[model samples]
Target: MSAQETVALVLAQAPVPPQDPGGQGEDFGKSSPLGLVLLIVFAIAVVFLIRSMTKHLKKLPVVFDEEKANAAAPAHVKRAEAEAAKRAEDSEATETPEPEETSSKPSQAKTD
Candidate 1:
């Protein structure tokens, strides 16, 4: 029950042995070929996707100002442009009816 007796009892027990050291060998990078192959394949796929995206993006304007300019044109200018386009598409050069204006609202519930 005394402190000195407790210390002596604790120190009298047998001690556990330390574990053996692990065997060291070649580096991890030199030990595996599959890891290197996977790394190369992933790098190539990333490069290919980036190139494909760049090619697709080049088909459009660098600045999209032309579309906004067309939308902001005066009504008369828009009509003239549409008529010119229609004339260019005519088969026999005969007169063609004008395209009707499309409404954004539904026709039936407009009165309500």
Candidate 2:
């Protein structure tokens, strides 16, 4: 082959990039810009979702603590009863008159 033709053949035969000795290029595909963008978008969406869920949880009202309520309920009832008794006693004392002392004068006449 002429020198010019030999040089052309060599240039054409050269691989775009030298292949690994193990020839693993076929198994590993190149990552694309679109794929990277999609990954980033997915990551951001997950973060936002987590943040929104946390905020929503914070907004939710907690359930009443039944055990604590049960423990405190007796004390509250007792206090209410005491207050009612005190009010009743106060009202009774204010509105009622003292009993009149009724004693028959010693019988002037002595019993036979």
Candidate 3:
């Protein structure tokens, strides 16, 4: 109802951060072989994940593009091939002309 009450309510509603020393927080009494084994397995998994990531990262270029980096190529070879094909088709279309009217039908028709 009052500013002081509202401030107190907001302060109470706000979540408090953990004041613990950021330790495991739980006192599992002591360690066990299963926990150690699980930890070692997870550690091995993390190492493998890091190695795999490094391998793939080394294969990738500094400036990578998914659409252009297909099959790890620098440029789009398919696009270049398509452009070459299109140019060849255009040149073929322009290089050849229609057949001429070799017959004397036009001259005969004119004379008639």
Please, what are the lDDT tens digits per residue for candidate 3 over residues 3-107?
Answer: 999999998895778867556567646788899999999999999999999999898678867766576554577789789999999999889677998997666
Rank ordering of all candidates by TM-score, starting from the highest: 1, 3, 2
lDDT of 1 at 73: 80
TM-scores of the candidates are: 0.36, 0.32, 0.36
- In model 2, the Cα lDDT at residue 23 comes to 66
Tens-digit lDDT track of model 2 for 12-86: 895776658566666577788999999999999999999999999996558778776666578878788789999
Q: For candidate 3, what is the TM-score?
A: 0.36
True-vs-predicted CA distance for residue 3, candidate 3, Å: 37
Highest lDDT among the candidates is held by which one? 2
- Candidate 2: misplaced stretches above 4 Å? 1-27, 64-112
- Cα error, candidate 2, residue 48 (Å): 1.0
Compared with the true structure, all predictions reach lDDT values of: 0.82, 0.84, 0.83
Give residue 42's lDDT in candidate 2 (0 to 100).
Answer: 100
Q: Which candidate, 1 or 2, would have the higher TM-score against the true structure?
A: 1
Clashing residue pairs for model 1:
none
Consecutive 10-residue window with the lowest summed lDDT within model 1: 20-29
What 10-residue stretch in candidate 3 is worst by lDDT? 103-112
